[model samples]
Target: MTGTANRSVERAFRIVDELAENGGGRVSELADRLEMPVSTVHNYLQALVETGYVTVEDKEYSTTTRFLEVGHRQRHRLEVFQAVSDELQDIAAETGEHVTLLVEESDQCVIVAVQEGPDAVNLFAYPGARMPLHAAAPGKAILAHMPEDRVQGIIDRQGLVEMTNRTITDPDALFEQLAEIREQGYAIDEGERIAGMVCISAPVLDKSDEIRGAICVCGPQSRIDEKRRDEIADIVKRSANVTQVNLDYV
Candidate 1:
């Protein structure tokens, strides 16, 4: 494509991303943000509207339902979490600890599903929570199973930000920990992301043995003592395997 055409496309996408970030915007606001003229922004907005990518509500422009439809379709195609929702809930009930399903997205872990335990303890994880790839058990478990180059790229992009005293801030040390997790078939986050919380996670693989996602059980640190930690790890690994087998059938 010509340089001018590429720039136009880039500007158009920038407008859309800005709208998505701000929830909505007016023509003047978009033009000011893009450092372009109002007429140019209006033209792009009109094109987006015609393409069913943006909508104008009460004179404020916002993303259209088409974007949501696209997101839904994409999630449906990657329905690993949906297929194992019930099994994860059962795991939480059996273990009396919160269970979470997480998928890696651009070096971050997105919680797709969470089932609260029957116990009174509250966990920090929830559906839609985005966690750093190196600070959480689910993130580390998925990272350990990912290709080395990809993992290194993530570390380069998002330096291991320390969330607590226990969080791994050194890249080499973190890589060593991930290597150990790869050998052990599971990962542990001992108050790494949140103080007083502990998470045990295992990787879920598909029929091709590709890492799809991860399943984790999270609870207070006091409950996951030395003796209980082993039991929790066993249950988390079994649950992950069960989910993987189901994914293989599908």
Candidate 2:
């Protein structure tokens, strides 16, 4: 695409993202935030309105029902997460660890659902939390199944930052680890990103045999020792498989 055309598209998307983040805003407010002329913001808003992506009322613009429709479509397709919510709760209860469902959102990994264990723990696995694609176990599991070029692009965009001593700082080493995780059909976070925490994750695949998301169990390093680690991996893989199976019916 031409430079000007790409810039326009980026600006349009920026406007939408800003509105989505702020809930709603007047044209002047949007123009000030976007650092563009009010006329330009009005033109963009008009285009978005024509496309049913945004709606304006009382001189304030907000996302339209069309945006909710898109979100609904995406959520409907996430049958696997819904199918295994109960099973994940069981896993957390059985293991006394946090169980989470993670899905790839563009180049990032987003936690869609979480079930905390009975035991009081410092770790927080709340839904809507985002993690680095290469650092966390669920994110690594999804990334392991992605194409090489796509993985490279993620690394290029979000250069691996050292979150802890165990975090992988080298891109080449991370790729090697991803290869191993793909072969094993699971991934591990050994004190990476957060110190004193360990996570095991397995990928969920659709009927088309495409990786959709991952199921994970995370806990403190003190509880998840060498033996418990293997047990957690096995349970996570089984839970992920069950979720994938249920998606077939849904």
Candidate 3:
């Protein structure tokens, strides 16, 4: 087999992603959106339907639940995710906000677990969601503990695309804040990713002191004022430390 990516496989997955992202589409719709010929799109869609990975209703193609099995299996296989799962609910209960556990993969943060408190704002964040490593508090917390060279490499690959007006786009300013995060043992996001949302996060590390992931508690700005941010930061740090200790024993 060739080491290079298989074009057929790539094309097939792109079709699947298109279906998923758009909810569903007809053959011509998919062809137009993917910039592929209608006949080629039909062939890939037929193959996916036969493989039971996708379904069609009234001539509209949509992805099936097969992806959930794969995603769930891989998430459970992460040691850090396993260690943090048991305590996330308690943290949510204590903070009455949204709690998320994310790990760095391919220089981006991937959410593995999410717990919603009673007062949690309805956010689009979900398991398997991926975002820039510098876009949020959890991502910043994870980056702050990373080696300097590694952090720079990630920045070089994923340029600091400003997600919002407040996002840190300058390398110098980001490094300065990362230093503060190192000293404080936690990081804060003040609507850097989404306006009106504030988050506090702390890194989770293994026994060897390497970053495993990060945990965060997030809420709206009105609820998470300066004083409340400090209190929540303390809670988030403690929860992260507890998860880290649990991982160390594992």
Candidate 4:
């Protein structure tokens, strides 16, 4: 591809993402957010509209439903997600806790699905939301199983940035925690990423013994006290195992 084509593609995607973030936007708004000229944004928006990927009304542009249709088509192809669908729903129903399945993407953990609990308050997890692997329970679960060299590589690229006061900031301490998580086959976040938020997660492995993702349960500190922590951890571990077994069969 020519350099011009590559840049055009990048700029087009930036407009798409920025439009999504702002919900609906004028060409000038998108141009300002992307630090590009309005003419460039207008040209890309026109192209996207012509391709039926975007819609415009009253000088405001927004993505079309085509994106969700494409996403649904893509989800149908991921057998791993299908395998754990029922189990995730059941776990959330029984425990009345927020459950999430996340996969590693670009050295970060991206939430693929979420089942909100009966409780009113829930973790702010959305499909495609990315969290640092060093900060979240689900991320730690996958990170723990990763080879030390690979884990180090991720840590090097995405330094252990602190999200909360309790977050593990020291590299050595974080490594130690990963070791413990590996031995126990589960990972825990003690108000690390979000204040008063506790999460327990277990890794979901594929048929080939590769870490595909993780199953996580999120709760408040009061609910996940020491006594219930083990209980929730055990539940999460079992759920992950069930998903893995189902994946193997699929």
Candidate 5:
């Protein structure tokens, strides 16, 4: 690209950021903040206003409602959100427990979607939150399905920081648990991430058998007890399978 085009793009972004940070900005104020000429700032502001991405009122420029429209459209377009939206609600309703979808990102568990049960407790986790990859049931479900190199990289970078006494602090023990999870097709977190909480998770796979993500049911130990462990795991496994099937169809 030409130097003029690159510089214009940079100046436009600076103008937008300056306006956003200051709530609104006049051409002179934007120029002062960005250390660019007032005429250049005005040109970018006009372009933004004309494109419907920005608006001017009382000679001040700011972002428009177009951003909200873009955000809503982007949320609906997410593949993971589409795959799990209805199923998470169904799983929560069926099991009477919290349902969550987690994906592995940078060796950590990132919550992508969540559905609370009727008797919801004060869960610390939520969508967009990150958790250690060695503690939660959803984390184990993801780790067990990850490639060996990826698992090793996680261990090297983020040594399993024990959140509770039950959390696997030893690398060898964690690997053993992952092996068991692989064999059983589900993982269990019995007061591991948080005391008095038990979570059961199963891996969601794609058509290529690659790990897509994990689904979990979380509740207090009394509700997710020893007698109900397998039952909860079976339900989780079913939901996971349905997610994969949905992905395939998509």
Candidate 6:
């Protein structure tokens, strides 16, 4: 109810994050990992258990299905997500790779929807997965359409954390590529986010020309080589355009 953050609530969320990250943990273990008091952690865990957000079994605390339920409800409420999700399967089938619909959230890329083709490889990407903006094609595609100050603010908050050797860590180099993405209407990630993988993405915009999200296709570099990159890029761009138009009706 207050503008300032409540320390107790922050500590409770920290406990929740620790449990989610490690799958589960004992009260003392969670307290030690979070640098909080044992009794404090125990108290928060009990409250969470009562609320059905967490569970305790054999004195070990872990998250419950409440989070998944909440996430599913919230995801379906987004108009952009609904619009883009419709095109993911088609794009995946056309490219024969993994396709994703992503949006910039809290200065990070968040995958909202994904569809896998017959040849798709399991990667770190999934619904609710977050990654750095400079490390992948979808992020860069969205960043290219953002206001200059907003992009600078994101860089200030997240920094250009390198995910792999091919990632762009230099701010200047990243800005240069963003400019090129603006010109070409798409972005490319060649083993940047993950070694041996390639991604192509296009920005989706609304009637006001504001960025809505990005649509992407990704696969192993062995299959998405230089000769095939242009073709895949066109597929991604077309899917993104269809989603952009669909946003108006949604």
Candidate 5 regions off by >4 Å? Answer: 1-78
Please give, for residues 18-44, the per-residue lDDT of candidate 1 as tens digits: 998899899999999889999999999
Model 6 / residue 103 / CA error / Å: 0.5
Deviating ranges (above 4 Å) for candidate 2: 1-76, 120-122
lDDT of 2 by residue, 88-206 (tens): 78888888888888899978888887788887365655656788989899989998888899999998998897889999989999999999998998999988978988889999988
lDDT tens digits by residue: candidate 6, 1-250: 5534487778788888899999999999998988888888888899999999999899988999899999889889888888875588887787789998998888989999989998999986778999999899999999999988899888998899989999999989989999999999999999999999999999999989999889989999999878799999898888888888889999
**What are the root-mean-square deviations of the candidates from the true structure over C-alphas?**
3.4, 4.2, 1.4, 1.6, 6.2, 1.4
Per-model TM-score versus the true fold:
0.78, 0.72, 0.96, 0.94, 0.71, 0.97
Q: What is the C-alpha lDDT of each candidate?
A: 0.87, 0.87, 0.91, 0.87, 0.86, 0.90
lDDT of 3 by residue, 147-250 (tens): 99999999999999899999999999999999999999999999999999998999998888999999989999999988998898888888888888888666
Q: Write the per-residue lDDT of candidate 4 for residues 68-155, one digit (tens) a residue.
A: 8887677666666887868788878877888888889899998888888797255667777889999999999999888999999998
Stretches > 4 Å off in candidate 4: none
Evaluated at residue 190, the lDDT of candidate 5 is 87
lDDT score for candidate 5 against the true structure? 0.86
The positional error of residue 175 in candidate 3, measured at the CA in angstroms, is: 1.3
| Model 5 poorest 10 in a row by lDDT | 71-80
Superposition error at 109 for model 1 (Å): 2.6
Prediction 4 global C-alpha lDDT: 0.87
Model 6 lDDT vs. the true structure? 0.90
Candidate 2 overall lDDT versus native: 0.87
Candidate 5, residue 127: how far the Cα is off, in Å:
1.1
Task: Note the clash tally of each candidate.
Answer: 0, 0, 0, 0, 0, 0
